[model samples]
Target: MNAKNSIAELARWIDALPNTRRLAGHELHNYRKQFVDGWRIDLNLAENVSINLLITAQFPFVSPKIALIDRTKFLSWPHVEKDGCLCVFPPNTNVDPYRPVEVAKSLVAETEALLQCLLDGNLDDDFNREFDSYWLLSSDDLRHQFFSILPDGCDSQKVAVWSSSKFRIIGADEKSVLCWLKNRLQKDYDRTDTGFLVKLSKPLSPEEYPDCTEALLALISEDAPNFLESISDHIAKSFQPLTIILAISATNGTNYGVVELCRLLRANEKVSKCGRSNRVSVNGFRDGKAPLSVQLSQQTKYTKVVRSPLERADAEWALGGRGHDPRFAVLQKQRVAIVGLGSFGSFLTDNLIQAGLGQVAMFDGDLMRWENTGRHLLGGDTVGQNKTDALKRRFETNYPTIVSCESNPVDWQQRIETAESLDGFDLVISTTGSWKAECMLNDLHECSGKRTPIVYAWLEPFAAAGHAVAIMERSGCLQCGFTGAGQFSRRVFDWPAAPTTMVSQAGCGNEFQPYGITDSLHSIAMAVDLSVECLLGQLTASTHRVWINKDRKIDPIQRGWSVAWQTVPNFDTREEVVSEFPWSARPDCQRCS
Candidate 1:
């Protein structure tokens, strides 16, 4: 906090001014006492605008708040805010807060320059110089009649205009206000008779911008040809805030709602206020072809603006810090193949999305049924949709790297059996709990010289337990963990010889292994961790991981819980069943470990 000049120097400087007076017992803003030996003076900065400069205790350390003392006589300008503050300096460019005299002198210099710019009728350049900051005045005033939400990073030359809450923007209209409304607002538009249309711009940059009254109307006239007649009909019929938003695509592909860009102009002696009468006249315009020009009430003051989306995705990302960690950079190049879209696979897919998969390819042949609503990610509304398609759409919308495969794993395996190899994936996951599908994937993984690692997971009947096997390239394949008959390879914990865990949904043919959504979620949780570990190149061995709920078995005669949650002979009586289940792959298996 090295201040450039002291209070005495500032006082000496202020004393030389003509209309200055020392004020005592003063306070600045809501806090603190003002300078006991400070000057309050008025300076004639411009011909019409006068400046009242007050030197508080904070003085040069903090820039003085400047305002035009007698502003009624001066014309409204882009550099002049409603409060008479001049846009003389850049936003938030406090070089040295502690340097009092330096800051004070700089403020005065900028104010002087701003006054010159205003007098020269060149204030519009100031607005364009800091366009984002100038818009702050109207950003908080939310009374605008029309709005649009544009997607970020889209290369669009389109529009979405709403009239009477219905998007009548179609064909030639879409090029107007092109984008908004989140999910809920979008649902409202869907229930109505609104439609979107694209209206392309030819070398489109607003010619006389910040002067929306002229530029926007001209744009509408140039594009639609009959837009002004329609606007004149509506203005004649109503006194309500008649807003017609023209959301055009920006050059940089970023989205913003076009609200306005106002530029002040000379007043017309014969002009009438908006909605006064249909038979109207405007200043300096000889033709009635541009009807919007007649709507002007004041001849000297005007403003024009281009609206932009207030809610930006990049802003949210900046605030939330999502997907920004350097640690996750390692996983950015990892490619994954998820082989099922059932309850287990869908939830596993969701976990992958949250954890940030770089490139993913999903394969599933089943359509989502009503029964799947209880445990599926696709939801009840997507009851008849293909599970892979639904999940792929969801991921690609948010993640941008997910691709839909041509077919399911089984069909895809057949097509590429004689090609240059299907081993390009970094990791392949299986969660189908289908023995046939598992066998085919295992066979694919068993092919020699392939480098793709595999992680297979399943929930036992009733979800009383779950298991995951992470097998690396050239390690034991899925076949090594079983005898190809639904039997685990000598599990540390064994199942009942005659298991009766099936529940009938539509008789015996439709019976399924009953499990709650939560139980399935827990299984996927373990599977996700193991898959991530393998992708990070941390896990190398072909091993088995399992979760066991102690009360899974029950007695048929007594209807009591069974303690038959038994493993092999060397079970430690003290260890927790849910945490410790590591079964080793056999060395003499067909698919060599």
Candidate 2:
């Protein structure tokens, strides 16, 4: 078939796919148009393949040749000479005449596999290997070479290994596993009613492997009942030291029971104290005054330390505990503002609430529409309710003590007003639909000179998945940080007269479309958890901006991770300006600025 007929056939095939009809149709048409024009086939193909598919197809034998064509575009692979020819050939089989349909099928399958790999978090070792192999391969060579790059091992065995072992190792490490478990517990258990116990066994001597085994058995036997009785068996387990870590569900002062158990173990002389308290505390073996003395408390005798009101006051004064320790209280009392009440924003709000954020201000001018029910947090009963109001109601019901404020009748303008109203808020977060909305919040923070941090969380549907949190302080504002014009800005400037539907495609329409809630929830939890780290001062200035790309599908999944911050000199050496240039400047911006 000629290029036109081939393109027509592919268009029909793409139309048959479930929901890709529109995008495929457009891409196919563009392919034909570019092909018909003088556009180089190689360049077109490189541009056409989505970034997600390109990353996935890194492996030679396992990936596909994704091409971009603009009608009648016909060119041989870059590795092939002037006469159309292929640099690679089929292995173990005769190279029958090449067919376009076969090539298309290979591309689609490779893209699908890449997406699956990304979702399963199984792309690490394969990433660099694929990149090195394909860095010089021509397009046609890529199409054929990928199939030949499969390892010599049996496919079934490889599948089993991937499913069981290698897959688990993708995101598993001591630090990541512990962090994941802590996040899980915070979401699953009530903050005020649960406590965790980390029990350490006696350290084994160099020649005590047998004794260690026996101690392990004994510790497992003692901990089995508690584990089996727990509501969920998904408790994270890690074997490092011979330690038993237990998270006990508590109500009121039931946490004290775990504390007492730790004290009892310490007193028995059978177990040595490794750590203690509601928060983990390192125990020192001896005081500075005694070189060889171990500070041991009396057994079964708990001391109050302070017997009278005056003594209690003095102890509090010494520790600087006026009402609550400022460090702990600050995290527990953060006031977060969710600027958009759309699908992604609503999901983020749910995660922030579940993560024990004390105060949340929801701002949105949109009313709950029927189309929103598919993906929004608020459902049937809230069809016509304001989005912010519905979110506030749900939040208050789940956490009665949580302070929720709804800023209805609020657009980007009113958002500024709402932000100004907040007194001593630690952070301002934006998930608004409009880039202008994000810019407004950025401007608000700059104008206030309050040094309050700002975080912008969002997900780009299908193509990219992750939220970008910018801690707007010393780091540049959102607009300044944007490397290129986003799709929305492009649509506004490239085709100012485009219809609303076209503009919507480049804007908020896809965000409202349905997706797996689990993935959405996972991304939101990551963003919120990182925000908590920022609030607690766990993240350094060098590691503040985080990008959680949910779309990574290579062998080693590179989900959103932190990017180090650049160094800034001390402010004393530079002249300080109070003018609104930082707040109001929109130089070279077509969107928010």
lDDT by candidate, in order shown: 0.52, 0.39
- What's the TM-score of each model vs. the native? 0.49, 0.36
Model 1 Cα lDDT, one tens digit per residue, 1-593: 33335566656666776776555443223223342344455645656445645444554555655555545422246665554545556666665666555666677778777777777877554444434444444453344333233333333233334445333222123332221222112223432212222233542322233344455556666665555555444332323333343333433332233443323333442323653333343455542434453544332134434343243332113222332554355555667778777788788876765565556677777787888877788787677888877776565544332222223533345443631354767788887776666777777667634477778888655565577888775555677667655455533333344344331110111125455687567667888988888877877676567665445345222222223334343433332244534445568766545
Q: Model 2, range 1-593, lDDT digits (tens) per residue? A: 45555555555655555434233333334332122211122211222333211111112222222433221112211222122222222324331123544555555665445434433546432322232222222111121111011111111111100011111111112333222223322232211112123222232221221122233224434544353222111111111111122122222111100011112232323322533222222134222222211222221122111100001111112222332355534544677766777877787777666555666777778899887777778898999988887776676554433434455546746545754554456666666645655656655665665367766666544323344454544544555544343332211122234344433332243543335554455546655766676677665441222222333343122223112111111111111111111222236643334
Could you tell me which 10 consecutive residues in candidate 2 have the lowest summed lDDT? 154-163
Q: For residue 52, give model 2's deviation from the true position in Å.
A: 64
| Model 1 poorest 10 in a row by lDDT | 502-511
